[model samples]
Target: MTKLEQIERSIAALCPKELKAFAKWFEAFQADLWDMQIEADGQGRQT
Candidate 1:
């Protein structure tokens, strides 16, 4: 199967507690990505 499918299956296997922890981690990961993109955009505008 594809890599994304593999990840989906793995995530599906997580227990309730593990899933909650994963969700929290994923939320922070997404926020970090957004912050990086915003910083890059600001730098580009300055140049």
Candidate 2:
């Protein structure tokens, strides 16, 4: 399985309470990473 799939499976095994918190944190972290990539790439553009 892919790395992400593996992580998902592991998260699914967690207790519901922990899983809910983890899901929210993971989503926010991923959004931050995506935003960082967009900003960095924009800075590197040839003009």
TM per prediction = 0.92, 0.66
lDDT of 1 by residue, 1-47 (tens): 99999999999999999999999999999999888888989888521
Question: Candidate 1 clashing pairs?
Answer: none
List the candidate 1 regions with Cα displacement exceeding 4 Å: 45-47
| CA lDDT scores, all candidates in order | 0.93, 0.89
User: Model 1, 13: alpha-carbon shift in Å?
Assistant: 0.6
Candidate 1 global TM-score: 0.92
Tell me the tens digit of each residue's lDDT in model 2 across 1-47: 99999998898799999999998998999999888888888999532
RMSD of each: 2.9, 3.5
